[model samples]
Target: MLENYLVRGLLIGIVFGVPAGAVGILSVQRVLSQGAAAGLVTGIGSSVADVFYACIGVFGITIISDFLLKNQHIICMLGCMLVILLGIQCFRKKKVEKPASVSHKKQEDRHQPGTIRYLISCFLSSFAIAITNPATILSFMVVFSMFRIGGNESIGEDIQLVLGIFCGTCFWWLLIAVVVSHIRDRVTDGFYLKLNRIFGILMVLFGAGIGVRAFMV
Candidate 1:
């Protein structure tokens, strides 16, 4: 029974994480700019937010969920603005001229004095972007209902499910980071610039769509 709960949770997590939303674009951009570690950290931040929403669903925290749903439009507006701003930043970001080896060394040095700051910035940005979408809880609720989860379940079972979700989400992010990092060295600066512009445009379009939806709701 525990295994069933865990496996279901894992599947749901992967399904949720697989979408190439703003968070996904940010993760890929970070991988191209910084390294695999940056991308993974960004994804971890998003995963943390996902776990928070998942907890609300698993524990049936109706009060919080209700409140979030009530103000979903405002939350979505904020998210839209945030995403658009990030998209602009991505679009305007200057390409790194230094060779990969030099950049890698500099990145290594960043670990010495600025590691905590860098990590916090990356993590918090993704978390903020993710948490603003209060609709995520609704998605969780729907998915949970479909899976027949969280109703009169033991605390132990719920905990197992949540842990499985975390593991599954983290695994997906790690895979993305690893794959992107492997190709990081082969890509030229021009390619990186082009990708940045492309992703930036996509993010802005995504934000615009969200904004429109927010108003329609």
Candidate 2:
């Protein structure tokens, strides 16, 4: 039974994470430009948020869902604004010249994200953006309903389910980071910059669409 739950969680995570949405694009772009660590951390942050939502779904937490649903328009507006701002920042970022280095090892290390700013940007910002998506929670609710979870279930079992979800999510992010890291060195910086601009434009468009939908609602 435990193994079954774990497999289901893994399937759910893969289904949720496979979409090349704003978060996916951002993760890849960060990997190409900032480094694998940045992309991995960003993906982890979003995954954590997803796990949280998964927990809520599995536990049938109606109050929180009700509150979010009630204020969805406001949340949508804020999330869209933030997405637009981040998109603009990415679009305007100037490429920095690489410094002359004595060793190949040093040059390699320079590409990885190590700064506090990058960590915070990748982690906290990703969390914020991910948590703002009420649709994710709804999707989880649908899945859980299909699986018949959240009905007089033991707390321990629920916890195990949530843990399974977290693990599954982490696994997906790790795969993305590893795959992207392998190709990070081969791609030219100019290509990354152009990719960033494209992603930025897409982000802005996504935000605009959300904003329009919110207003219409």
**lDDT (10s digit) by residue, model 2, range 1-217:** 6666776677667666663556777787777766677788888889888987887787788898888877888988888898888889878876732222125776566646556566777898888878887777889877776676755667767777777777777776778878987887776667767877888999888778878867775
lDDT of each: 0.85, 0.75
Deviating ranges (above 4 Å) for candidate 1: 97-105
**TM-score, predicted candidate 1 vs. hidden true structure:** 0.93
lDDT (10s digit) by residue, model 1, range 107-206 = 5676675766877888998898889888889888888888887578888889888988888888888998999888988888888888889999989998
| Model 2: lDDT of residue 100 | 26
How many clashes does each candidate structure show, in the order listed?
0, 0
Candidate 1 residue 176 Cα shift, in angstroms, is: 0.6
Hey, what RMSD does candidate 1 come out at?
1.8
TM-score of each: 0.93, 0.86
Evaluated at residue 201, the lDDT of candidate 1 is 95
